[model samples]
Target chain A: MHIAFDPRLRVAGPLQALDARCKVLAFFALVACAASVPAPSWRAPVAFLGAATLLLLVSRIPLGAALRRLLFLVPVVLALAAVVPFAKAAGGEKVALWTGGPMVPRQGLLVLWNVSSKALVGLLCAIILAGTTGVPRLLEAFERLCVPRVLVLTMSFIHRYAITMQEELARMKRARDARGWRGRWIWQAGTLGSMAGTLFLRSYERGERVWQAMLARGYRGKLIGPSSAPLRLLDVMFVVWMLAAGLAIRFLVR
Target chain B: MTAPAIRVSALTFRYPDGTRALDDVSLEVAPGERVALLGANGAGKSTLLLSLNGLCDPGGRVEIGGTPVGSRNLPEIRRRVGLVFQNPDDQLFCPTLFDDVAFGPRNLGLGEEEVQKRVHEALHRVDLATLEEKPSFHLSYGQKKRAALATVLSMQPEVLALDEPTSALHPRARREMIALLRTLSCALVVATHDLEMARELCPRAVVMARGRIVATGETSVVLADTKAMDEAELL
Candidate 1:
């Protein structure tokens, strides 16, 4: 299966000029604030949704594209939400699904709304952050936050070449299809396995040659990139604003 | 006289699966020399190139400027020998062209300012200064190759080894690469099946066949060996 993460979704334009670490930290803080509030507290969800909407407007990302990208998770969210009412605890309060016996509780419906709202808010925040910032900048921020170099490098490589690998697979599939291959499920399964095996072997060999190239250029087990730009005063202000807003919503409102 | 830039004697290598890739290969490259290694497919040209940087340890004699290729000298040897693989994708693994070019210098523990300086100079050398911030995957094949070259050149290697340097370049790109190589002072050893490239870029040529050296001499004379080329099925 092909994994598609659109690089264009990464932050671009003026917002991209803001520090990446600030955006990442702000995202996590907002998610925490959104997730912790009780189901009865509709104010938290409203506040979170407002913030997300503001971010989308300011970041200049099309709302339609953001929703479309997030739509892939809708089925899974709905399925999980479907089960919430049954397992939810309520004091003898029963809710009917279709004019029959109790399939849910009143509290369970509230919990379902709570879960769905929190998930959407969190997902939207992430989508905005990812859509605005470039992958390299994000990695730089991650490294600054002390993420392991190897992990960052691995993720970057996967992001860069995963598309190329997918294209290779598509070409192989086409080649197989062109060779008088019938539409038999069993034969297709065998061909698919062979194609996967071939792709793995090719990737392994490519990794070897890449490593050798690294060695030839005096690599000695350390990954180094350009000197990261210092965190700007405005970036610090952004972080402070996020923290203040979150604390106000959490403590002041409660 | 000074030791040859690269020296290999009776070099033989077999894969872990027992496939013989190089068999008793021997060659010498002098300093400030540009030599082209010519061989058909499966003739062990790539294996020999890898041995030059100790990337393929065949347990045979390999010396760079009289220093043996071993674990103790690997870092030093690597600093002196730059090998550009056949595929630029393999060489340009970093996200940005600047980082890829600066990777070698940074690995050498140079200061940040020094690394930046070297990266700029190397990119300038390859005419890729404007592409520093561009992602490698977005680059054209010619630009990727140039970036790969800059990656190695940032390390200031004394000898450059390239595998099939002109296999997939357009005519203009090929000419640009040849001209760039000619302008550089470092010794170069290129392994390729492109005899026309050999004639244009190298002063010396070595013909390999089935993991053995078939002929070596001045580029024109060795390439003129019609009998040998006919026998090796390369003519």
Candidate 2:
């Protein structure tokens, strides 16, 4: 839980200094703003892209690295939304490709750009938030935001045991490797299935033991959290500033 | 007659799945007495501890500070009897060290101020005051063990039940745990295979075998007798 090894880039910059609650609210607000475009209007999205870039720059984080990350997911966005242009086009025109099943439509390229840019913006914002805040801090932030305790606790447990689960997988892999069992998923279906079942049972037993520990500590179903202190001046300032700036840019761009 | 810190009389506990874990076990620890529960694997040492404060329902009597371990008095019993599990990972499920330490006191319905004070005191006692904001998973094994103990200590229990406290610790960490145990004033019941540690910290000893108490006496005496130790499979 402490070691956040989410396969995402997080440049620990000035943004990491603000309280996690502020980061959660501001970035999630950014997510909402990015998602609200009725159609591909460059103004609203480009404004968001510019704001996000400025945020990265002001935080003293490197922009090129984050932008480079956007490269990896570009194909995914294209795969999902690229068909919209080709399949749904009114067919006023089409361009032939050297090797293709469907003729390349001119409208498809614009649609590709439109879909990708939005997806990139949303993902980058998430990466920035996760990169900066530790999972425990993020969970605390979730608690402060009045998220349901069950959901919060679930995330917290997932964060805590994810590494444990990974380690278990690694151990199983090692054991398999030791026995010269280079597994093809189809060929070793039974072995893999059994492994998954064993892991589930191990995890289930661990959960039972953890629950017993909680009971010993007087856990009465209601989670007793450390009382949260009032929001600090810096936290308040960061949230207000981000909300105002994001809303203002959205309106001005519109 | 004064009530013992912990009392179990003819207690028997069987797991729901039908394993008889404990059988007619009777034991008592006087106030402020440090007792080592010595036993081998599958000896029901853990089951007996679980029954002490009603985590496992006992067939016979189990009491903490004169209060019976039942649903009506479980809340009070749990508060007075803190059970630290064998694995720190099992006990420390909270996000941060502060929250984990404050958990017990907060459950007791203490005020925020009191909870904070107790959490601070517990951390200070364990010499982990600096790690209050650290995630429980981030802590080293030794630190997590100490943090787990602090979680129980925050409630200021009259009797502290520790299950294999030094099981996974290195020699230095084990010695440190012993030192920490030496300072605490509660009635301590430590179940351990480390006879050396039991002799160092606990003055009294109770040896369990096959869900029954095979021997009970001064720590040195119980640990000294080779025939009894052999019979109990402690060695």
Candidate 3:
């Protein structure tokens, strides 16, 4: 499978130019508020989505790329919410689609709406955050936000090596294919299993070497982050506006 | 006489599986000198290189610029010896080229200004100044290799220990790497199967076999010794 090592677009824009820490805080607030929106609240979720789309536009991220990333989570969310519309809630109106088909409850549909809409808003906010900020700056933002160093370091390594691991697995698959080993049958999965074992072993060995490399370059126990700049007035204003918007959505617009 | 950039005497290492990686390995490289570590696979060249920076659990004396390679002086020793691993992927672990290059300097507790200065200088040295924001995986293999070198060079190590620096490079990239390595004045001990690179970049050569030093002398003279090369399975 083709995977982008980094999903952040190279383009610079207003949203991309914002301090990562502020962007992170604002996005987090927006997502939290979106998640907390009442099940019956359509206006709040729509507003949250509109704001996310606006941010995406301001970032100058191509709509096609953002939509592609957004679509990746849609299927999973739909699958999860799929069952909700079929379940009849207590004392809720149920409508049958067919002669003997499962009844669709009105409350269940609302529940599905709550789940899918909230999830979409959350995912959109995440996509915007990731698309605008590079991984290094995002990690630095997390560090500045008081995230644990070990956790940040683990994320950094995962971001750096996930693609490498994928490429390694792909190469192993190709090597397997080159040896005239096409396993179309269920029994042929044993070869794939062994390949996975080999990949694990290779990754383990590489981890050791990477550790050695880190140590050889004076890596003490601490992982150092990029230098953080002081938050600008614009960053604070943007954050305040976001927080107010989130709180307003939760309390007002009923 | 100036102190050796690296000094190893009677160094030995054994794996947990009872495999000996290095045995009684004694060698030294003077300041500003370049030496090539040549041997076949499993000949302990990489193990020896790791020992220089106290990365290997070894028995015997290993010194970097008169400082012993021990737990106490590990940070200082590591700063003095920059080891570029055989795989660039193993070395460039940070999120971006800039972060990877800045990692060593940051770890040294240098101020941000100094770290940035070193990172810029290191990237410029590797001709990756424009890609400081690019991720390592996005880079071509050759670029990743140079970024890995920049990761170490940012530390400004007095000695550089590179394992297979030109192993997987295309001919042009290899020549570029050779040209780059020639510009450095620090002591260098490169472990590789690339005899041509050794002939071009190093004035001295050390050959290892079965965890032991099989030969050591002037690069041309030692490389010309057919018996030693044959014995080391490097011929």
Which one wins on DockQ?
A: 3
B12 Cα displacement, candidate 3 (Å): 0.8
DockQ each = 0.60, 0.55, 0.71
Question: What's the number of clashes in each of the models?
Answer: 7, 0, 0
Candidate 3's displacement at residue B70, Å, is 1.4
Looking at model 3 chain A, which ten-residue stretch has the lowest summed lDDT? A1-10
Give the alpha carbon lDDT tens digit for every residue of B24-45 in model 3: 9999899999999999999999
- Tens digit of per-residue lDDT, candidate 1, span A1-89: 21124533444565667788888888778788878878766667777778778877888776778878778769967897768876766
Per-residue CA lDDT of candidate 1, range B79-119, in tens? 89998988888898765788788888888878889999999
Off by over 4 Å in 2: A1-23, A56-78, A92-103, A130-146, A170-194, A222-226, A232-237, B72-75, B94-99, B102-121, B127-140, B224-228
* Tens-place lDDT digits, model 3, residues A1-254: 11224544557788877899999999998889888887867677777778777877887877887787777777877786677776656677887758898778877777777778788888778777877887767877888889998998898777656665776788898898898888989999999899889988887777777778888888776677766778899999989999998888777867
How accurate locally is residue B106 in candidate 1, as Cα lDDT from 0 to 100?
82
Model 1 chain A scores worst on lDDT over the 10 consecutive residues at A1-10
> Model 3: residues >4 Å from true position, as ranges?
A1-8, A86-88, A95-103, A176-188
Worst 10-residue stretch by lDDT in candidate 2 chain A?
A1-10
Candidate 2 lDDT tens digits, B96-196: 78978987898898989999999999999999999997767779999999999999999999999999999889999999999999999999999888899
| Candidate 2 vs 3: which has more DockQ | 3
> How do the candidates rank by DockQ, highest first?
3, 1, 2
